[model samples]
Target: MAQKRDYYEVLGVDKNATEDQIKKAYRTIAIKYHPDRNPGNKEAEEKFKEAAEAYDVLHDPQKRQQYDQFGFSGPGMGGFGDFGASMNMDDIFSMFGDIFGGRAGFGGFGGSGTRGRQQHRGSDLRLKVRLSLDEIAHGVTKKFKVRKDITCSHCHGTGAEAGSSSEQCPTCHGSGVITHTTQSIFGMMQTQGVCPTCGGEGTVIKNKCKHCGGTGVEKGEEVVEIKIPAGVAEGMVVNVPGKGNAGKRKGVNGDIQVFIEEEPNDTFIRDDNDLIYNLLLDFPTAALGGEVEIPTIEGSKLKVKMEPGTQPGKTLRLRGKGLPAVQGYGRGNGDLVVNVSVYVPKTLSREEKSAIEQFRQSDNFKGDAATKHTIFQKFKNYFS
Candidate 1:
């Protein structure tokens, strides 16, 4: 066997390429060489698998670092062996379903062949799920009901009554396709189409099912539970295989696409994975340092220390206290940015007025000439 090509060369990217760049390159290669697009072409299929393997390694930071440092014989090279000969079509499509807009399968190349008699796979179902900031920070499971077509219990997906079964189509002789010959000016041409008698199903039901009227599916509601991953952004889709509408006449069921919708937080604003929290501090606390307890996304109170004479626009960072990375190897948690705002008193009591008058008259309130001049210049700039 020939030695495998370098991963970066296979993906057509540099060693310093970002994750998005690597993924985009792989997507282009995979789509161009997809088996469905180039049917029965062994070279295209091999190229597709090679691109998948390259993406699998380069998109991960740990694997990319190891590959860079130690080459292919690195310590973490367990699954980085021969690429093309190992994976089947299903494995490749299912693993990278996200790149294809949450859809996976190899059926685009359709004609009169062994696959003709098989029923088409059901259509995929999409629904939105709204999650709170806490739920996004930590993964959560959500349950909801959806109305779709399910296999008929009475017919068992055969579209026939309990005692009888489906009969082979007479028009196409169970091939589900009809061929027609036409005479043109140059020569004779043959065209293929679905059999009118069987409607491409290749079977006819004599005793139709009572519940679904020979369709083999019934209107039903199913409660599906989806386990949402942590750090999923809004509009990201989570696919659940075999949870969608049932296929017609024993075909494969489709997938359930769950779209993420993050609810707006009342106290915190999310920016990517990081969370921003605005903290209001009194004038005394700003002048004299104090400890303030703030709430975290994980339902914990964290005491933050304010420095003396802290500015109103000052930001305090709490590292690794935010959402986790959604895909691949985690890039670690984000930060909780605390933005301080000083609150000024609108009204004061008699005791407060007396104290302010005393402080104004004190010697400590009077500064040197240069300091006063600098203060006056700053005030003038602010007004100007």
Candidate 2:
């Protein structure tokens, strides 16, 4: 699939555009590319939907903040499923018809004629899950018992009692909308609005379901399964569509937003995808280098060779030993960094001090100018 255009670019707005500005931009695009204006024009319809999608994200404070911080593929942005793409032309009309001053399917100014009843969308649900470094590295699936509104079993989402059915709304005569005609300077103009009696459902239940009180929904619990991608960081959200509260009166289900929280690990310090381990070595081990075992994120140990006279602040890099990058951000896994530190005794016994004094007197054991200069250059390089 082609990469989605940036939300700002799609609506031709700047990143810092105000809410009103964003709404104005979307309205302009919607009017220009409306299917009513360009009937059967697939490209125009796509652009219209694209503009709506952009407007949907930019107009909402929370979604806009997420988009600004993480871009298209960020957490809770729902890069896996595009919302506008999943909707139809009728869905768009029902959603934003009010924005057009009630001219959606009315008989004036590029109207598409009368449309079906409006369908309401359920509200999104938010959840937070804590993950271990291992789980973040490998990715995992989690199950949650979510408490939210669910479709009523007795009414079967129709809002009607058993052995009963919904009848045409008498106010609008089943049209789900009321058309108002007025004579103005521009001649006779007709605008449409949703019927107040039936709330745009076109039908009304004479006998309401006792269980859900005619709303077609009730409080319930659902077991939802979510698959988390690897390399996700804290505060990032994963969206599970159609897993939130059920919409009223057989409408669409909302989404489940999963927030990620990372659990701290005892052995490693995380630096993005990289892992940092501070290895403390004894004086003998630092002076006469050998192989030392290092812990890995995979719950295993890796043996690393230490060169003779290994100095403190020396870093050893093991390639492909770190965490993997989040999908679509980058490629390949990160490296493991080992920082070496040599342990020094606070006090020395008399015999040990005498042996150390003999070595201190030797030229080989005494620090030379070249050695001091090398050490100074290393420190300079490190700081630089």
Candidate 3:
């Protein structure tokens, strides 16, 4: 027997993932490895079973807590049961049937061993939203109108017209699939295909809807409002459920994926949650302590003090002034690092040059005063 992989590892999620996160990950993995999507493949079957087992354990609160502390089988846990021997395809489907909008099978395909064609979820839509640094610092809500396919108002999502309905497909006889047998040297072999009469819907409408022309959907526009959380980074996807194109014949609606694009801040450069600002100080201000006003991300002025002898490349930290953590981890807010740069005069007047020359000749203006002070302090300490 092979060693069982960690539940979190199998689902491609962190151990500290929330229940929603765990379920979302399982849904993605289940769709990818579903048997209908990879028919007659043993590897896919094993992966499907593995995902089911992971979801079964992690979805249960008590089981998850015990699993986290003791792993598969420890003190109180009755061992992570074998998914292959325990769960049949129907069992797995029944457990998570609601994931596929109560279709009772893997998505994009029908239930196992059943030839009926299932309706597929609508395709996901992707769009980019540009947010300013201010908006990222504090959460913002935005609304945008998107054009997509929606169920026809006239027919209420059914292709049939008013006072008329659909009948079972005559070609496949409501089976939704057509099976044919072929003779070969070995013997007769059976093959199945979708019914041509109803196009896998198992029924054919006698009177089609005038609005959608029997498609049961039409182009429409809808306003989608999204609230962007604070501290969101570029390229992060915010999923809006059931906002994409409406599925054919009233199937499940898809998701709207909003990709974040952060606009550059003019006053500060963002690095993770921290903000960096370059502070420029004059020679006199660097030599003599003074206070200067700097712009913050929130369109406010922040007073920063420059200590006497403040040198270039020195960084001043302003705690709790940066953006909050997106995931609520680590310190919630970051610090603002003010990088000091001494400003040098491009051209100096005669009086300015004379004053500088006088300062250069002063007795207390030694170039290595800091070095001498350090040496004297070391000698005094040694004597003590």
Give the alpha carbon lDDT tens digit for every residue of 1-384 in model 2.
778999999999999999989988988899999886775599998899999888878887877888888888777565323867766665566556656765753323223556667676788899999999989989999999999999999998888899988899999998887776756332454556678899878888999999999999999999999999988889898989899999999998989999999999888888988999999998888888898999998888998888888888899999999999888988899989999999989999999899888988888667689988999999899899
Which lDDT values do the candidates have, in the order given?
0.80, 0.83, 0.79
- In model 2, which runs have C-alpha deviations exceeding 4 angstroms? 1-114, 180-190, 377-384
Q: Model 2 scores what on Cα lDDT?
A: 0.83
Best by lDDT: 2
| Tens-digit per-residue lDDT, 282-330, candidate 1 | 9788878999998899989999888887767679889998889987846
Instruction: After superposing candidate 1 on the true structure, give the runs of residues whose Cα lies further than 4 Å from its correct spot.
Output: 1-105, 108-115, 180-191, 360-384
User: Between candidates 1 and 2, which one is better according to lDDT?
Assistant: 2
- Alpha carbon lDDT at 127, candidate 3: 85
lDDT of 3 by residue, 128-153 (tens): 99999999998899998999988889
Ordered by lDDT, highest first, the candidates read 2, 1, 3
Model 2's C-alpha root-mean-square deviation from the true structure amounts to 12.7
RMSD of each: 14.0, 12.7, 11.4
